[model samples]
Target: MFLISDMLVRIVPLCLYSHTGYYARFFTYNVIGGIAWVAVCVFGGFWFGNIPIVKNNFELVILIIIFVSVLPVVFHLFKRRSENKIITKPLAEVVEERAN
Candidate 1:
């Protein structure tokens, strides 16, 4: 989940030039990936939500959601800071710079 968007932002353009009809390939995998995540979140929640420990802790579930969602942004910021890169730089600019 964290990697997908990051990957698309950074890697998809390279794939575009290197592969024939790369977007089609991405779409295929993207659908499968989406379905897999949905299944896990829904059925896994249903499967595990019945557990006494998990079911009793609504706060834990909220925390898990916040952690999963926010950690990626924090990691991205940290990576940019470490590399002395600007987080707000346009993706196209980064792609073009790397290409040269």
Candidate 2:
């Protein structure tokens, strides 16, 4: 799931760079970055998994971790929605206001 999300985040930049003829550099950097990312994730999980609390309550810990991670995304979505509502004006209202 993390890898999929990471790939999704990279897709836009990859497409842009590829279109602009930087595919080779992008590919090289992406490979190196991907390896480092995987290594860190694996090592971090291995280190964390050895904790007695985590091992005892693995499921609860993962659920809490997931919920915590999702909080920022939820907050961002709500914030963006509020900003859009505040900034957006109806076209007819805009035109009428402009004419006045």
Which candidate's TM-score is highest?
2
**What would the TM-score be for candidate 2 when compared with the true structure?**
0.55
Off by over 4 Å in 1: 1-40, 85-100
The residue-by-residue lDDT of candidate 2 on 8-54, one tens digit each, is 88698888988999999989999999999999999999999999999
Give the C-alpha lDDT of model 2.
0.93
Model 2 residue-pair collision total? 0
Tens digit per residue, CA lDDT, model 1, 13-71: 65774587577777787789889999999998898888888889978988998999999
lDDT of each: 0.84, 0.93
The positional error of residue 62 in candidate 1, measured at the CA in angstroms, is 1.5
Query: Cα deviation in Å at residue 87, candidate 1?
Result: 18
Model 2 CA lDDT for position 69: 100
What global local distance difference test value does model 1 have? 0.84
RMSD values for the candidates in order, in angstroms, are 13.0, 7.4
Query: Total clashing residue pairs per candidate?
Result: 0, 0
